[model samples]
Target: MSEPGKYVLAKPIGEAEIGRLDLQHRMWLTQHHGLYSAPISKSSKQRVVDIGCGTGIWAIAFATEHPDSHVLGLDITLPQPNSAPANCSFAVADAEGDWSFATEPFDLIYGRMLINSIRNWPRYLKRCLQHLKPGGWLELSDVAHRFFAEDGCSEAESPMLRWWRVVFQESSRNNGIDIDDTYKHAQQMRDAGFADVRERVFKWPVGSARASTQEEKVIGDLQYQNLQVLIGGVTETAVQHGDLPGMTAQQAQILADEAKRDVVENSDRHGYYMHFATYVGQAPR
Candidate 1:
């Protein structure tokens, strides 16, 4: 269980993790070839809301891009720039609670990488539906926790994978949430009375060895750093929740070190990749 006054994510809100999240925002942009997969370009005034908007990077960028749009970013911890764009604003709010701040319906509602944070996804979607205008769009981006290998390198059998499996499973169990809930996003949106639902999936390489193109290498490198930052938090969460039986903090650190070594050395050359999914739905007009 998460301690009081702390968000659902296991990691501490420090410079290192905040920096990782900024890089992750860049990675998502590179992966999608833009700020968002949904069609958000509009010449007229539009109201946009970003739920669980860490760092407010995406909100700022979108506000900068669409000057006519007013973008509101909401999160538990609003670590935003001192001087944001004229059209952008941020607030400290919990996504799980009632969103009474939204006085009017939003034209675009966005969320990213919130799978682990959200407890009741169906209710969340229903709330999103209520806050969206008749023709408004809601988009969510999330990644699967499970690892995959294209080649028969057996890296999936590695201790790193084992650690992630246990940590994510136990974390979800303890929090009463589904860490891999994005797989059901489309159905959930439909159940919430959304229309024109669409889903996109991307493969994110784990290491640079499998990256043939320059873009792939960049994504791979960023992903490698992402994993490096995640291991510690995963282990910490596992220890806090007593997920990994008999695993000490020192032992967890050792495992994290070994996992980093394996990735850096490319010892297995497993061509491992993770699945990133984007789901978009529109409210009935």
Candidate 2:
């Protein structure tokens, strides 16, 4: 059961999480062309909803950047001692549950890095469709569970892949929400009646030491920083499911550390990266 006024979430929450999410917001901006992937015109007055808007960083930034737009950030819990622009506000909500908090239709609904707790893709997307104005857009972005290496980069895969697999993919399934099924979200969106669905995939490097370009090096370093935070957060969850339950927290963290180390020490050799995909679809006019 979740706390009163809190959405049931798999992620651990705290001050550290807030900082990591803010960092992730910055990292995402460095990786993407803009705050979001969908092509919404700047001049048009818009109503935007950010699902799983951790720390309200993205929503706050989006509202501040596009002052003409009204951006509302939604999550299971809202941050305390938080402040936002006049056009930006936040509320507590679970995307899988009640959306009645959104009194009116939205022009754009965006969800970022929230593939873990969502169980029903098509149903949830259909709900998003129902909440959208005609021709409105839906955008979702997340990193998938594969860590790959290019030719001459490394002969073996990074052990970090194992950490992601067991912690996110395997453990999520044990709780009845399969993170791997995110690959099917685009098709599921189409089945839910979205139109002109498109997906963009980018290879996001794991560590800065091996990147060929300066920009990539910066992003890679950011990625490494985020991974360290994630490992610390997920260690307990990793211990709870799969073959790891009953292990001490320190033991679980040890495994997580090993994986992170492999990424740092072997980034040059492994060319370590995972696929970061952004899915975009529009409600029918």
Candidate 3:
């Protein structure tokens, strides 16, 4: 478990966070090219569970795609549970806490961006393994949370990078949840008895100013907006959990403002992109 005050919802459970969560769902679709990339069945009897289903967008979409299948979306809290398909339902549950709410095995189990939220991944993967049907499929995703310059423009480093490093990397390190472990997810899944694990990397460009095509521009715009929300949310996290000593709120804000400006200005320059990855694996029959 994280420190008493370490884990915090970046934004409260309200309209603003609801908007961000919904936008985040849409952004991932563009990044991954679909609602799902795993080869899970769309059979009428198929059963799926979306771990950490925020607003139930993914669950609602999946339920629509497989009307005969029952889809359960689980999260600690959902801001506004939209009127979902008859096959879809939402429940308030913590993935890191008791998973007793799950009564039976599932055909496809999906988790995404949870590496940032959950603490004990090995145990979580083990629980996922135990809860899966024989030969069930599992798909997971996470953000690496660092910027990269497309061109050799290392001089374009910004305080945003520092803040990111402090909050996600250093803080996670302090809390024993190294965020950099994102790269080892496939292996971890394998260690947890998952088979045929594969990891696919993706890039999120920060702005559309340097996009070469229309699709790229659209994705860029979405990603830029994501960063804007992220910046607003994570700045406090950095101050609180980042283990940065003697940093005042005023100091942090000044640094964050300059960092946002740098990100905007540098976008027109060499261009920076953030990388994330999705892992697909299966339980052995």
Candidate 2, residues 1-285, lDDT tens digits: the string is 111121111222234423545556655556663566676655548999999887787787778777888999988998543667899988898999988877899999999988775877878999999999999999988777555666444323556666666554555666776656657767888899999787766667777666777657767888877777877676666675444555565766776888778767776666777677778889999
Q: List the candidate 1 regions with Cα displacement exceeding 4 Å.
A: 1-21, 152-157, 212-214
Provide the TM-score for each candidate, comma-separated.
0.85, 0.82, 0.84
Give the candidate number with the greatest lDDT.
1
* Candidate 3 clash pair list: none
Per-residue accuracy of model 3 over 1-285 as CA lDDT, tens digit each:
111121111112233323545555655666655567677754578889999886777787777767798999998886366477889888888888888877999988988778767788888898999889988888887777466777755433656566566544555666667666777778788899999777777666778877776656767888767777777667777676655566777777776776677776766575777777788778999
lDDT on C-alpha atoms for all candidate structures: 0.74, 0.73, 0.72
| Candidate 3 or 2, higher lDDT | 2
Native-to-model Cα distance after best TM-score fit, residue 225 in candidate 1, in Å: 1.3
Q: In model 3, which range of ten residues has the least summed lDDT?
A: 1-10
After aligning candidate 1 to the native by TM-score, how far in Å is the CA of 149 from where it should be?
2.1
